[model samples]
Target: MATTASTTAPVSLASVTLEVADPEAAAVFHRAFGVDAYVGLRAAEDAPADGFRGFTLALTVSGPATVDGFVGAAVDAGATVLKPATKSMWGYGGVVRAPDGTIWKIATSAKKDTGPATREIDEFVLLLGVEDVKATKQFYVERGMAVAKSFGGKYAEFAPGTGSVKLALYKRRGLAKDLGVADDGTGAHRIVLGGTGASFTDPDGFVWEGEK
Candidate 1:
């Protein structure tokens, strides 16, 4: 008689669940750079239980913190803490509510194949919102982001170098349409400055700058 052997595949992270009141606004924030809004509402709604379709989750954290600390910070950041942070059965964990009202579970370790937890010290990406794409592209070119590609004359992508994160300039309305979300008419301008090891949004309503 022949016998069958069973095996299970390793699990991994695919995408960070960003719960925002407006998915379109979040999409605009990301598209200002070059993130493709590949998945829409139906997909996003389904991904959590599906363990993410398969991209490589990139999450943001303020810093190392215990369950209480995490919860406190989340609450103070203009967000409600839906679930009080608590230890999970799994070794590394905590949970909190994001500004957009999405529940985010904090974990110290992810499956090995999920990819690095953070960018290198000198590397980072800036996702900004822009009113006009063409003008922004010209502005970045002057600021030193070499245009790498243009998408149908609406979105412009730039890869400055390994030391700096890639950048994208996108039209807000078009970006929202492409992402299948409602556009929040914030229309804020930001100038991202590279090489400072820090990022700041200008108070003049002119620009937001991100640096190494």
Candidate 2:
């Protein structure tokens, strides 16, 4: 019997898709969070992954993970696989549930490329809770966040696609619910002001600051 050659290459962490009641709102909040520019804010559907000019973070709309292929690959690498891949409502390729139950999906389509790609990470995100959605939205807008789009009244998105980092300001109650937490802003729900940037809290009780 002849042995077949292995052709399957490993998958990289292409995008981290977060499922929220309002994609637009989430987008706006993320822009304020200072990660919009980090991922290049280009719709994955609009162009090829390479079509993106500057990438801060990529967003892939998919279900959750509920299998071994995705998480297994991460584990194979040096990083510890928090959760096994599995099915989810958000529609991630494969969801990797973190130890804290924070669902994280792995990219199944993106492959490791050997090109002159600039991979310089200058920002990170810190999730927070807000009581008022409208006020929170305005706060970031006033701060110079460009509202890319709005999904009805359910959500709004903002981000400087070609700038420094991005930001995401979301409804406290809704965001907490998605994180499988209560609406009381209880437990570990403080937004992490990454790096050494300035931070502030919103009217809805959400805290944020720029990276230093």
Candidate 3:
């Protein structure tokens, strides 16, 4: 009998769930931050998580004013400022840690506000910090994920497909430095990704289940 290669459909991120101690509070914060629609909250009071969670949910917006708007709203919703919104060589952005311990980064490539500030999220990116970018990249590729961009062994981004969230990979230590957090964590990531394909866990231990 002849054998044929079995191929899996490309996985697209459909939803993101963050395990929090208080789902109500987390929902309120996300609502205030104007990203409630993008992220889902689940109660997990005993989920062991500390320091950096090995990932960051990034929001790409229109301009500086939008960046400031999101960061300010996040701070007012009880999030701690890790990096203030400021213009950098690349663009303007800021980092915040939600009360539930999820790190978020809001940014834009435009230094100036093109229009009035709005709570519009142009792009939602889930950046996973992995030990080996090349290995992880290959892992996803084998799973049918197409690489949208690649930079040697430093970073790799996958096509979003029909999902709302874009997925990317970065070096663990480098990602920590970018978020201004120490790259030391030991516990559940407390984050779950919903995919269009079968449930599976990535090489970095990130959980991905069928979309609900």
Candidate 4:
């Protein structure tokens, strides 16, 4: 593995293919946002495993109207609302989970003046709640991803590639608690990541596939 320095690697998420039980249904809900859904037996499985840990999809759009529109569309398509859209530290947005068991955060930066949304999902981030942020960040760094920003062992953020999704690391317990879920996330992550040196699962159990 070729580990990059703290801010040197060019690693970024290319796509997030979620393993879902019903690709058809999941697609119907996620289609608007460009989320690829496949039967993973997360697509083929009959039920969510005990302590099923879910990941959050950060949908960074243009502004409030776009945020409300997109997130509302998801809810209409069968997504459960985890948080209503509102102004937050990050921006104006909310959270929801599609029927396929994928959670999403629909948000926008308040400082942005980017008009309306250009795509259903402008920016995509796969936020993993890890047991140890330091170790996890190091694991990725060793695998060639450079750290864009980090707060010691608490949280770490990666910058986007030319056209890649962002990746971030946070403490598992704190993240789960923020999402109002159990820290012991079980079951498959049902996520597919591209644009890495190789394919492997992190210590926290989330799996990744390689693209570059």
For TM-score, the strongest prediction is 3
Model 3 stretches astray by more than 4 angstroms: 1-7
Greater-lDDT candidate between 1 and 4: 4
Error of 3 at 81 (Å): 0.3
User: What is the alpha-carbon lDDT for the whole of candidate 2?
Assistant: 0.36
- What's the lDDT for all of these models? 0.37, 0.36, 0.89, 0.69
TM-score of each: 0.35, 0.42, 0.94, 0.80
Which numbered prediction scores highest in lDDT against the true structure?
3
Each prediction's RMSD over C-alphas, in Å, is: 19.2, 18.7, 3.9, 4.7
Model 3: C-alpha RMSD to truth?
3.9
Clashing pairs in 4: 13-165, 20-42, 20-43, 21-42, 21-43, 21-44, 41-44, 41-45, 51-186, 53-186
- Candidate 3 residue-wise lDDT, 24-56, digit = tens: 989999999898888888887576887788999
Between the candidate structures 1 and 3, which one is better when assessed by TM-score?
3
Return whichever of 2 and 4 wins on lDDT. Answer: 4
If both were scored by lDDT, which would come out higher, candidate 1 or candidate 3? 3
Task: Give the poorly placed runs of model 2, Cα more than 4 Å off.
Answer: 1-70, 73-97, 100-129, 161-165, 176-190, 194-198, 204-206, 210-212
Residue 37, candidate 3: C-alpha displacement in angstroms: 0.5
